[model samples]
Target: MLVIGAGLAGTEAAWQVAQAGVRVRLVEMRPVRRSPAHHSGEFAELVCSNSFGALSSDRAAGLLQEELRRLGSLVIGTADQHAVPAGGALAVDRGRYSAALTAALEAHPLVTVERREQSELPGPNQITVLATGPLTADALAEQLRSFTGRDDCHFFDAASPIVEGESIDLGVAFRASRYDKGDADYINCPMDREQYLAFRTALLEAEQADLKDFEAESAHFFEGCLPIEELARRGEDTMRYGPLKPIGLWDPRWGDVNDREVRRANRAYAVVQLRQEDRDGRLWNLVGFQTNLKWGEQKRVLRLIPGLENAAFVRFGVMHRNTFLESPQLLDATLQFRQRSSLLAAGQITGTEGYAAAVAGGWLAGTNAARLARGLDPITLPPTTMVGALTHFVAEAPCGDGRGKGRFQPMPPNFGLLPDLPERIRDKRRRYGAYRDRALTDLATTLEQQGCAARTSSPHGQV
Candidate 1:
């Protein structure tokens, strides 16, 4: 068995294959060749936020984490071990988590860690798992493009900027969720009309970073992950309608709630949300503010928003090339290429977004690759499960052109992706809880029927 790339998906895939008693060769091109976003050769390095999203079981991300735990996922298990204290979420010390994963993979006797680049696809008989993530090198990306027979196999993805929490003017910024829903998890920076207009003006006039030759040639940004400046260009009110809308949010410092008119008059024209990036609330990322602005411009323009005037930047927003397959037309739920069963793909490259979703793809592809090696039939998780719903969606979603030329986009896990409950439950919390319950029950039954239920034992213990 062979696996390419040592990212979250690749590391998890190699671990599963080796654990299945299959000798696997894992190749990584990091120090030898690094992506624009990456800063190290470490395996599973987190280039974006440290967070893995909400931790409530009824939530999509939380439920997926539970499922991975039940299936004994290495990536999630390692994350759990090195986890920092992120309230109601699983976040890790990025450096520690990556180092631990790299050490674990290197120590595995059945796993051969190779430090080099793979410019081409492996032979048909190799039974390869192509876990190379979104930042696939040009040579290999072109090879994949040819194999998939598609001209548009890539898109631009952006990362939001992080700011030091201490530098934020807490006196001006307030912590609250829209309509006071759930916990007061987000930091809100209220902006009146004058402030909003000024900020918009700054964003419009900001200097942007230059794209590489390849990226510049085909500058297509994914609709789901558009840059902040791109949204500004859409319309004067576009940013307000999208990320900066101020509906259902109220800051107590505005006035006494007893005076309804006074409260109503103080409503912000727009609001900038900041999500906590670390356990200690030391780092906060500007929500929905992904951008390609140059470093100086980012500091100059972003600080114009209230509360961020004296903000210290931890990391500036960046835009980079993200390559992915049109999985709806090319892959089966088992993650195997329809045209070449021996070759499997996983992670963001397979059109699945989010860190947990990437790990789910790795689990399926790795397990199936090992099964094939052992002369056993590969298996797919029940579609009722989050993992199953995601894999199935990628493989079976309709393509725009009947023959699969366009119209497939990357998907993040959500309750909507799961099959509806047998009976209606209008309460969102109950409905989500029902979905979680059904998924776990169905997953257990499927594993038992397939004679693989005992594989739930985790090397890092239960997550």
Candidate 2:
């Protein structure tokens, strides 16, 4: 069996195949060739922010991580082993995290890690899993396009900038989560309407990075991955309602809603959030601030936000070209290509966004690939599980083309993806918790029915 790419999806898929007692040849194109977003050959490298998002199971991303852990996910295992402190979020020391994953795969007896570019999908007699992520090699990407018979959909994705934590103006920024939920996990930079409007005006007028000639020029940015400035351009209040929403996020230091007197300053009109990027909290990522501003412009403009006046940037926000299949036309619920059962697709290529969503796709693809290699039917988990819901959605999500079910767009796991509960719960927290509980229950039953287990566990540690 073969898995192509060494991204989060590919590495996790390869590990799952090997753990299921199948030998896997994992191919990576780095060093020999590198994508615009990658800097090294490390397996599971995180080029953007290191966070896997909120730790509490009630959250969509956190619930996905919990599901992966419960299913013995190799990616989550390595992440946990190298975890850094980010309050209620899971973050990792980037170098250590990748090193640990690389070492484990290197030592896996059933796995062979190779450095080469594979430009074609496997022929019928062979089993191949494609987890090439968004920035797939152009040649292979072409091959995929031909196979799917659908012109690939194109989009612009962005990454947030990181700043030195010490450079943040603590006097202006306060540490807290919305409504004091969880430990104060974020550094909030409060801004009055005047300041927010000023920043918005500057963002609208700021210069954008030029797109490379070879990259697809698309007017559409995935709603979930829109650049901060793009959001700003949508409307004056679009950013406030989206990333900078300040409702329920009052700073106790200024708000009067303390134990007795309700007389502090009212909540800011808009807010910018910075999340810890490492265990030591030395680096902080500008949450939901992905952008395409030129480096100088980014530095000058971002510093306009409160608490960032003297900020020192460690990494500037960047926008990159991304490609995805019109999956509803070509894939089954298990991620198997409809025309070729032995060939499966995973990760961002299948239109699921976020790190956890990628891992979930890899898990399902790897599992079904192992079953195919063993002469068994490819198994699909119950739709009630986060894993099942995600895979099923990719296979059947709306597509406007005549070949698909409805309009297809990239998705991130959320309660809306799950089928409605039999009994509705009014409280948001309880409702989310109910969804989490039901998903886990359904997952256990699905695994039991499928007879899936860790036939062999991958060894984990720093290289």
Candidate 3:
């Protein structure tokens, strides 16, 4: 078995293959060649944040971490061993975490570490897991693009900032969707004329983060994912018509809409929507507020909105050059290419965002690759599990055919991706808890049916 890149996904893949009694060659191009984001040649280096997100099982990221732990994930297990204090989230000591992972993989007798670049894909007879992350080198990225028949395999990841749900002022922000078309899913923050204009002014004057040379060279923002400041700069009312549009929404707290006087007086000039970021509704992301603003500037400017006065930010907005595949068109749920089953893709390159998500992809790909090498069939986890939902989404989401038509985008783990429950549970906490319970039970059954061990080394293993 062969695995390319020594990042989170690649290292995890190598470890899994080796654990399955398969000899693996793990290749990494660092020190020899490094991306702009990396500071060292360490395996499983976290480029953005050290956090694996919230550790509660009721949360999507947490559920995925638990699933990986049960299935023997080297990355997550190592993270746990080197974990630092981060309250509800699983945060790690970066230097310690990466070093530990590197040592483990190198010590594995079945795993051989190669310090070099792998520019070409493996032959059909060779089962290989391509876990090269988002910042794949130019030569290998080009090779992947050509092989997959995709020229546009990259994009600028302008992610919006996520806020703690409990921090949002519910008195100011009401739950409602535009025109009441769907369920009252969004938390709407209505802004009057004066407030909207003031917020726009602050955005225009805010300081933007300086981009690295590589990012600056390719800083073109997609129209669909434009930064909030960019939209504000277009026109005073550009944002009003865009994400902050207040047309179809109405706040019940502003008195009965049946009363003409009350409706007219309470009409908002613009509104900011907060979409639920997790199943438990603990985190909410500012809808369409993707930006390149500096971290301090983001908090200062975004807080000018009515309900976010004391908002607690979970992850700030980030704008960077990210290379990912249009996986929906090329890969299966097993992470294998449709045209070539021997080749498998994992990590951010497969459009699974976040550290935990990358590890999950690697675990699945590596396990399946080992199975195939041993003359066993590759298995796909049930979609009810967080890991399964993420893999299935990347492999099965809709992607338009032909040139310049693919709409597949990178996605992080969220409850919205999972299949709905058999019966409705109204309480948010109970509903999320139920989802977590179902996922773990299903995962255990799958592992048992496959005759795989239910538990591996504990995550709290001595460092």
Candidate 4:
């Protein structure tokens, strides 16, 4: 079995295939070929935020993590082992995380890591899994599109900027996470009513990007990670409630909020938080500041922040070419191409967002590919699970079918999409717990029927 691309999805796919007792040739183009967001040649290199998101089980990210654990995800295992001090979020040192993953995959006896670009399509006899994520190289991506026969498959992607921590004036931007949560791990830039209005004006007037031919139509940004500029365009105060929320935490220099409440002299109308980027604490990333603005314009507008007057940019925020298949038109629930059952697609290319969902797709596709390779029956995860819900959503979405399913949109797993609980529990938390409990029990039963344990009971840390 061959897996193209050593990204999160590709790596997970390869690991699962190898675990299924199949030989895998895992191909990576890094060091030999590279993408804009990638700085390392290692597998599972985190391109955007280090945090996989909130760890609370009720949250989408948390529910997905729990599902992955139930299914014995290798990526989640690696992330947990290398986790940093991120409070409720699962953040990691990107360098160490990628290095650990690369080492583990290399040490696997059944898996062979190949450092070469796959510029062409695979022949019919071979069982190949295309987990080539969003930033897939041009030639290979074109080959994939040709094989899939779809034209509606791409959306733009962006990255936030990194700044030198020492250059930021502490006097202007105070160090404190939101609600004083998360161990003072974030630096807050307060925006007074006047300052926020000024910032909004500049952002609204900044030079905008021309839409690509593929992006000429209206497209939606993922709700959780909407671009900062897009948020600004929605309304002047939209961001204040969203990313720029300045709740909890009173600046000591300005006295406590209670002390100032009697007769307020000054107060922050909005705020921007920057998070530490490296262990050395030399750099910080603008949280939720992903953008597609021109580089020169980005510098001009971003510098308007209170503490960033003379900030030194270690790496400016960048926009990448994100592409995804019209899955409703191209793929099945198992991630197999509709026209070619033998060819399976996974990762962001399949239109699911977030690292966890991409890894889930890889696990599903890889397992099915191994089944095909060994002449065993293919298995599909039940739609009750987060992984299964994501898979089923893509396959059944009624977009581009000339039916009433509206426009095709990539989705992250949410409770709204999951099956309703048998009994209605009005409380959201209790309801989610019931859903999770039911999903796990079903998954265990399914795995047992197939003579497989969702996870091994052995002490092996390798997933």
Candidate 5:
């Protein structure tokens, strides 16, 4: 068995193949060559935020992580072992996490790590797993183009900013979760009407980072990860309705502040949320505030938030082009290439977003590849499960919007992709919890029917 690339998906695929008693050739071009987004020769380098989203099974990402852990995922296990203190998120110390993964892969006798550039397709008889991921090199990408017989569809992805936790003014910002449902895991900077308008105005006027690879007009940016300035341009109130929505939060310290500051007695007109970025709670990321603003302008404009007036930034936001395959038209639910049964693609390149989603693709692809090597029928997990829903969506969702030219971008895990329950449940959390229950039970049944292990490892997270 062969797995190309040593990223999260590639590493997981190699591990799975090795666990299946197969000798695997894991190809990685790092150290010898590099992608624009990666910094080290390490396997599973996380260029984005360290978080893997919420850790409870009631949420979509959390449920997906739960599923992967039950399947004995190396990436998820290593993440838990190196976890940082991200309030409700499964964040890790990136340095330690990547190091652990590299060491494990190197120690595996069934796995052989080869560091070189793989710019072309493998030979006819070779059963290969293409997990090169989104930051694929130009030559390999062109090779993929020939194999798929279609242009690889892609979008721009952005990373949110991280601020020094202590720099935020407590008198101006308050810690709270929406509706206080969970722990006070988020820091909120409130904005009144004037303040919100001013902030929006500045954001609109701020300069965007220049891009040389793709023209602005031809730039294919994911709608969910659009730059803050782009949202500001859409409308004066767009930011408020989106990221800045002040609903369900009330500031207790508002009355103690000077009345002359024009602070609202109730909820503010807009709010900026900062989520804990590390285990120690020293760093906080600006939630939903991914941007392409120039560095100097980012500091100047971000400070406009009431609580962030004196904020010290740990890291400014950055934007990168996220590449993906036109999966809906090219691949199946098992992530197998429709044209070639022996080859498969996984990770971000397959149009699945987020860490867990990428891992799910790797899990499915690796499992099927092992089955094929053993001369058994490959499995497509039932759509009721999170992994199945996401993989099926990638394979079946319409590439075109009704008007006819909108291509399949990327998809994150969410209940919207799951098959609806027989009975409607009005309460959102309860509804999601019910969905989680059904998926897990259904997953167990599917695994048993396929004669796979019911429990590979105790899950690192909970429902």
Candidate 6:
């Protein structure tokens, strides 16, 4: 088995294949080759924030983690063992996590880790997995484009700014979660009706980061994390409906809310939440606030939030050019390129977003590719699971329904994308719990039927 790009997905895929008693060659073009987002040669390098999202089983991300555990995901297991405290979220020490993963892969007897750029397709008979991720090197990316016959395959992704916590004006900013549900770790900037209106005006008129020459034609934003400036350009209330929803918050200093309705109206009309980015509590990232505005303009405009008037940014948000294939049209449910069953694609390159989802895809592709090599039928994950939903969405769904420029948008696992419950359930929490239960049960059955152990050390044992 040959796996390209020793990123999160590729690393997981190579591990899975090696554990399945296969001799695997894992290719990583690092140190000798590099991508825009990666800085080190380590395998499974996390370029973005360390947090992998909510860890509660009731949430979509949490449910996905549970499913991964059932299927024995190396990334999830490693993350738990090397976890950094972040309240309910599964955050990790990025440096240690990547180093641990690299060391483990190198130690695997059946795995040979190679450092080379795979610019073109290997032989037709070779069993290969391409988990190159979003920021693939240009030369190899072009080769992939040519192989896939895709003229335009790139997207633009932006990172949110991290601010020095002490530099924030606490007199104006408050620490609280929406509706006070979570811990008071999040720093919020409240805006009254007038302030929200004014801020909206400035945000819409703020100077944006101009598109680069290479990005002018192929730039598309991920739907899950759209740039804030793009949201403002759509409409004044777009942001209100999207990121600025104030349903779950109440300002305590604005007088007692239980006493009178008029007093509650004096509360914030809009709000922005900043999540902790580090263990020291020194930095906070602007949540749901990815942007491509010029650095100076970002500071000037974002400070309009009631609490951030004098905020000092530690790291400004920056955009990266990403490339991906239209999976629904080009790939099968197993992530095998439709025209070439021997070749499989995984991770962000396969149009699935998020670390957990990418790793799950890797597990699936690796298992199926191994099985095929061993003269076995291809396995498909149960559709009830988030991992299966991503596979089904990419493989079976029709790409175009008269929509302009018919394409498959890269998506993170969400409850909405999962199948509806057997019975009508109005409460979101209850419905999500049911979904999680169903997925786990289904995953358990699949693992048992395949005779695959959840976590294994012996190469000879099937279960």
Q: In model 3, where is the ten-residue run with the lowest total lDDT?
A: 454-463
Per-candidate local distance difference test: 0.83, 0.80, 0.85, 0.76, 0.81, 0.76
Query: What TM-score, to 2 decimals, does candidate 1 have?
Result: 0.68
Q: Per-residue alpha-carbon lDDT of model 3 for 1-463, expressed as tens digits?
A: 8999998899999999999999999999997998888989999999978999988888888888889999989898889889998988899999999999999999999999999999988889989999888788888888887887765476566678878787799999999878767899889999999999999999999999998888876675555577899999999999999899998787878778667787678889999998775445666778788899999999999999999999877578877888888787788999999989999989999988899999999999999999999999999999999999889988877554623333455678877677778998878678888898898889999999999886743353310
Top lDDT hit: 3
Tens-digit per-residue lDDT, 181-258, candidate 5:
789878999888999898888998898888646434325545556788989999988898888999877665656433
Q: Is candidate 4 or candidate 6 better by TM-score?
A: 6
Q: What lDDT tens digits, residue by residue, belong to model 1 across residues 201-265? A: 89999998998865654456455667899999999999999889898777877677447786688
The local lDDT score (0 to 100) that residue 161 gets in candidate 4 is: 73
Which numbered prediction scores highest in TM-score against the true structure? 3
- On TM-score, who's better, 3 or 6? 3
| RMSD to truth, every model | 10.9, 12.1, 5.2, 13.6, 11.6, 11.8
Cα-based TM-score, every candidate: 0.68, 0.67, 0.78, 0.65, 0.69, 0.68
Over 120-149, each residue of candidate 6 has an lDDT whose tens digit, in order, gives 778779999998888787787888878877
Pairs with backbone N, CA or C atoms under 3 Å apart (clashes), candidate 4: 153-324
Extract clashing residue pairs from model 6: 179-248
Number of clashes recorded per candidate: 0, 8, 0, 1, 2, 1
TM-score of 2: 0.67
Which parts of model 1 are misplaced by more than 4 Å?
Answer: 155-320, 402-406, 454-463
Once all C-alphas are superposed, what RMSD does model 3 give against the true structure? 5.2
Which pairs of residues clash in candidate 1, taking residues 3 or more apart in a chain or in different chains?
A: none
